[model samples]
Target: MDWLNYHHLLYFWVVAHEGSVSRASEVMHVTPATVSIQIRELEKALGVRLFRKAGRGLVLTEMGEAVYRYASEIFAMGRELIDMVRGRPLGQPLLFRVGIKDVMPKVVAYKLIEPTLNMPEQVRLVCREGDFSGLVADLAVHRLDVVLSDTPLDPNLKVRAFSHLLGESEVVILGERKLAQRLKENFPDSLDRAPWLLPTDNNVLRRSLDLWFADHNFHPVIRGEFEDSAMLKIAGKAGVGVFAVAAAIRSEVETMYGVELIGKIPSIKERFYAISAERKLKHPGVVAISEAARKRLQ
Candidate 1:
């Protein structure tokens, strides 16, 4: 390519960031026609189309997203450069962007991220929660520094990421004080027909618990199905029914939910992973979380 023009790149970046030429022009204090001309010049310089219209909105094409990521970083660095040269004493905090799978237990997620807050280096943490697939998609695009999930990346899926096992622990079955006292009489057998709050089928722990239940023939009547693990715990705390939680965060759950522990399911354990681009972790915050989790959970 010929010598690049930072001006054209800036215009294209704003347009991509705003998702509309008109919006970008408003922010740039220029006309929509000027923004359009700049973007066209950028596309010609880069030799790749950046965006496509999707109905009323402009959406980034695959190449557009890739270019946007690079441009975002470049402009961010440029801003930092000015601050440093001016001796502004404005230190930019390191970004620790983590993507959490929707099914991950809230307590567990807190435990994992808590270490970043204590890092000696100033860190700005950002967390995004969604399904495994969507989070992986974000990770693939450099949007996420790391991904915390219950299950490893699917081998069938073509995501170029590796899973670092954080830790694993048995699960605890908890219920309200009254239900716990009543169920404590017969214990394991008592849960056979008891009302139970369960995670949806999308959760790995749920599938593992299903197998354990089948093996022991402990079929509890499903009281509710929740897509969010935190909601399931909330419902469980409200006496909706008994529910299971990772033993790693059992104490936190009991305290937060004010629930009594009924029993432990050691046979069915819940596993946690930190998915990232590197085979071996390099991020100090991520390393701290993984190290602390292994030591604490074990």
Candidate 2:
């Protein structure tokens, strides 16, 4: 059985955090040479160079950054354990990391994630936003507890992930007050040849909207395309064009962006999913989000 040398690991952790051997030596009350020797031994055991010289300062290598993350968690738990043994109240919050697909509506994401804050345990929520595939890649390696996306996991990605559909929302057309007022009476017919702000073709909502347009034979004048939902709504607020949002967040959109609903298309639904590496969700924060989002979206 191989045993890890926690003392050597401690030295490496301090050096990484302090960003220099000399500073770490001061923190540890040890000579710079002693700190250097301890870190070298740790690197030898781990078979990775944790730091590299950049100009006059030292920086962590790629592997070092990963190690530093683990070290941070390990030390945090160590302190918590000490507090537990002493019957002191634990101050550390449970860390819940989530990834959001860039195309996911910000209001929708906020609604879905809001429940985790009300959980019994103290939770520190961390959110990252990126493209779908990139977020899925983070989920595959366990960097993200779960990913919130408008679409389900693609089987072709070769990742072992399960997509739990939270719920679906009817699509709603929205525009600035005057534009919505002009179109409300005519509804679907009013949309024909109307200046339209749309999601780029790559988005699932865009594709669904395209299908709906074809089905109704409504030809909208495309004024602009956006990948960001917020930007699209901003343009709509300026009356640049009409836009679509999930009915689930219609009220929020109206309040936040000051846009009025032009019409609702129940036939066009926007679905949301919580994609996780686990076949069954086991994290408390994730479970809270999934349960609450399903109810909210429904």
Candidate 3:
């Protein structure tokens, strides 16, 4: 085996963990072809086929499975070494990268940690925004130090949950009319009568809406779908349709777009969690951010 092939092992590890070249590519921010070529090169250098086709996805071969077991440990140790080097008495501030669900209010989330960011031990805060699954995947890959999200995580992930509150709110939006009389007149008994702006099908909020409709024997007339709440709010304000907005965001919606809350619908209360890998709880940056989120968002 080529002694310099350790770099390739990192690539292999990502592919194995992600279960697909395309997914690994997205996580690594590389092309699928690049990931495939590197994996092939790693296999060639090691003189074995690491994976074989299993239905639509790749499954590890016997050799591949054994290699993966060791690869995980090797990469983990490598990360520890890197951390050790960075944590040395350099007297410099340590940068902590944190991810938050885009659905969350950034002002509230940041204010929670504002004090910690100015500690004597230089602490730099890096914030990223994404949906629940994307943030979790980034955390699993070690790309993000910690994540704050309103969605529950998979049991397989090793996470420390700091907040347990089930925050419930209705999915509502300001109707087209600002005047109370006009809004009251336009209110419909069933949402099916109005064109609705919904989040993508995969979103937890969207799923809750679907469940509510099923229970109530109503189907919304979906005018369009959006991935971002800000965009949906814009569409709602423009009278494109009634868009879903969390109660937490109602004030922003009202202030920004003059949207009037027409009615409340039955939707599941969202659960917000400040989660990090169980192993990373001891890391000062992770600990600080987690505590901050728990204090404010919980």
Task: Give the RMSD in angstroms, all C-alphas superposed, for model 3.
Answer: 5.9
lDDT per residue for candidate 1 within 1-298, as digits (tens), equals: 4698999998887777666999888867899999999989999988999999998879888999898878766765564465347632358777788999988887888898898899888888999999788787667545787899889988755445789999998888999999888887777888898999999998888898788788879888999999888889888889989999888888888999899989987888888999986666777778889888887664
| Candidate closer to the true structure by lDDT (higher is better), 1 or 3 | 1
Name the top TM-score candidate: 1
Q: What is candidate 2's CA lDDT for residue 197? A: 98
Q: lDDT for every model?
A: 0.83, 0.86, 0.68
Per-residue CA lDDT of model 3 for 12-66, tens digit only, reads 9788878899988987899999999999999988899999999889888999988
Deviation from native of the Cα of residue 171 in model 2, angstroms: 0.6
Per-model TM-score versus the true fold: 0.71, 0.70, 0.63
lDDT of 2: 0.86
Worst 10 residues of 1 by lDDT: 80-89
* Ranking according to lDDT, highest score first: 2, 1, 3
Clashing pairs in 3: 168-269, 174-260
Which of the two, 1 or 3, has more TM-score? 1
